[model samples]
Target: MKNIPKVTALCLSIVFISLSSISNAQQRYTDYDPIADFYNRFWSVPLERLAIGKLEKIMLPNLKPKAEILDLMCGTGHIAATLHKKGFRMTGLDGSAKMLEFAKKKIPNMKTILADARYFTTSKKFDAVICMSDGLNHIMKEEGLTKAFTQVYKALKSGGQFVFDMNWEERYIKGWNLRGLRVEYDNSEGIISSSYNKNTRIGSIKFWLYYPIDKAKNTWKRKAWELTQYCYTPQQIKKALQTAGFQTIKAYEANQDLGDARNAGRAYYVCKK
Candidate 1:
């Protein structure tokens, strides 16, 4: 073959390096999945305070939940605990053992099962299935999206609905160009933020952990942790749901009624099987 131009070769080399680093960055580590940490601290912590109100006003109000509610991808059982307190029968399902451990500690009375979101079952079916907080965007492939919807369809009662949301790529593109930010929860741990890489379309948040070497000493310590996930568009999500046997489909923007708005960047789907 002919020799490649230097400029073109350099660009190709940069892409290869980026891809290789992404692979190693996501490589699973010692009983610690970065996603689990994110679930445990970042979103879960805030949801613990906000999910109850959102569910009551946004999700559960429109319809009644006749039976139990399945919180698929329920990190730390944050929503489950609220439902449990409200006297609504609720159960949590998640694939991350690390997260489930923290969830158990938080909601000792609530029941939790370990299973992948794409294929999970329980002894009893649910009247409503809610997988919120951009859990829909985690389906890195078209097939995974269909499988998840199909499985949720089988698990829900005929009149029940599968509700979930995803952030738009526009949000990622608009946000990622900015440099990383720092938000320290304490000396030990804090959040460092960065928006999407336009070329790669990957957004990330790095968590830093600093420890005290000694109470009497002047110095402390530091550790680095990172989490990343792919982003998806509304069109891709809608097509996947339609193909997955959902008969009635409603898509909405963030903080809007569960009605169709294809152009909306942040999307929520209320799918009836």
Candidate 2:
């Protein structure tokens, strides 16, 4: 009886430590639940346009008309909607339920899957798979990146293409270093701040959005969240793609290929399985 208390305490301590470690691991990735509305409303438009333009130039020409396309990390379904209009069958897959809610609302007839990019499987293989707006960067480890590529590979048809963009180190150094970090709207204001750790090759961006709940009472509400991205070298990415059975891989510097000044530190990869 005397020793039972010590054993219970030890088990409790182990459980606590395990839970804490799980939480810490989860914190390494961003949860889009809180910011899904803000992102859908404020941030996705221009980026969607840019991505569409690039896709048209780079990936669309290689596809058959009405090709089956999978939009991986397809937040809000904007790209899927646009491509749907262009005559392709679109299916969106995203990790965030809130983001998928918006996506489903946007395209009532479209199919959206809520699953992690690293492990999602589909009975339907796609003609092309796209992960846009630095989506792959959110996979914070090389193992996760490789797994994501493998899953994408498995989801694609034979000779299918995978197209995605990633942020290079220069993007974090120049863009995320507190540049253009503040914005205001009629009813809300937002501030974004970020940091990049060279040693870990990780970058984190924190967002704070404030909106008025009652103008007469001067009452306001604020929502805050942080997101992290990992920076992988081109060599690392290419190797992972090859390991995932992508034989024909071509990389293009976004600004050079698209002639867009905004894409200075971004690169796009087109891989064929």
Candidate 3:
């Protein structure tokens, strides 16, 4: 009896440790699978417009016609499809398979890769690399940000440009944290909640969505997910880019540079390798 009790305790401890490890792993990466459809349908358009406008001004002019471009962390493929229409060779890379499914559907001939920004490798170099819509913010650690920048640097040819956008404290506070919580669509409804920790410089958004499952029976299903982002100052981002071997860097406030009020608190960067 005494031995049985000790054995049970040890087994329970082992199970607890295993579960903790799994949870930590999950927390390290945000899984977009659950909300990929929603993002594709609703969230991709405005973000795509912002990225395309900035790219036209800062990236396209510097590249030759039909130049190769890598859309890093490309979600839903909206921007890639737009660029492809403009005669650019577009390659989309994203960590979420579900997100890439939409992209592939949009551009059947486009090359899409499912890989993490921090550790992706490419067989061919690109003339320009873009990580837009605050993609780099998803890399929650400074070391990871540096790793992603290094990967991007390696993926680009000499003299190639790397352009990206990021949100600072202003965006999180005024945009996400203070925005209305409820969103409604024809078939589904969502509630959004967000928080930012100044000390950790991390922001998180939790989404809860409800939709019809069995319309005849008046049944509904609910899905929930949370996403976390880290806010790095321009100085910190510039340091990371420099460490990754980018020499010339220019930063632009999107609201001032792009002339869009919706881009308030967003900053764009253009770097040359």
Candidate 4:
């Protein structure tokens, strides 16, 4: 790593130790399998809109109609599908097999990959790479975050840009520190509860999905998953990007540069490699 600023160096060191703690916490948890099946029905439309808006802001200055782009941690390919409609060549990657399955079904011509963002790589480079909707936060540790950053840097062609967002503490205090959040579909209902710990800067969401299997008999399918996210200060994020070799970096309020992202409760970063 190049010589980082003192404050940034300190932040990087903090992330080094935090990774172990985060890993321990992770071992106690299990992945949510059904969330992938539920993703499109619940979150795809709004999240895809915000992501497309942000990408337009970054790409409008000089965009190639068929620019090769990678969507990291792409859940259900909502954003990629939107970009594809605009004539961009899009690839969607996510760790969830079910999510990618749905994405492939939805976009038969689009390419999808099943991989973890922290260690994902490819010989094929891209014009731009995007990790949005608090996808970076899902890494749960600074070191893994840095690795993801490095991987993105290496995967981009010269002058390629990386765009992503992370949740702010303010977002956690207001959004995650809540309970009894409920979503109901015609045959499926889900109860979501969220909590955040200031000391650990860890936010967790527990989702209980109930789906009717038999209408008259009232038989239901119950599935659950626990998700965790870590909060990082702007300094930490900048430092990590810098360490990953991003030369030009810009930070924007979720909606300042992209209207659709206003009050999105996350900070967006655009970095050039």
* All candidates: TM-score: 0.73, 0.84, 0.84, 0.82
RMSD (Cα, Å) for all candidates, in order, is 9.9, 10.7, 9.6, 12.0
Q: State the number of backbone clashes in model 1.
A: 3
Provide the lDDT at 168 for model 4.
Answer: 83
lDDT of 3 by residue, 174-270 (tens): 7777343777755766677888888888888777666666656656666566777888998899999999999899988877777767768899899
The models' CA-based lDDT, in order, is 0.62, 0.80, 0.80, 0.74
lDDT of 3 at 134: 94
The better candidate by TM-score, 1 or 3, is: 3
* Candidate ranking (TM-score, best to worst): 3, 2, 4, 1
Q: Tell me the tens digit of each residue's lDDT in model 1 across 1-273.
A: 222112211111111111112123333111233346555666676755544544665567766544578888776777777777676677887766787777788778778887776666666777788887666555556677777787788888877878776777865665444343444443343335555665665666455544445535434455565455467666677777777778788776653453324323556667776
Q: For each predicted model, how many residue pairs clash, with residues at least 3 apart or on different chains?
A: 3, 0, 0, 0
Model 1 ranges off by over 4 Å? 1-42, 48-50, 174-180, 183-191, 212-222, 255-264
lDDT of 3: 0.80
On the 0 to 100 scale, the lDDT of residue 29 in model 1 is 19
TM-score of 2: 0.84
Which of 1 and 2 is ahead in TM-score? Answer: 2
lDDT, candidate 1, equals 0.62
lDDT by residue (112-183, candidate 2, tens digit) is 887878878899999999999998898877888898999999999999999999998878777777733776
Poorest lDDT segment (10 consecutive residues) of candidate 2: 11-20
* lDDT for position 215 in model 1: 37
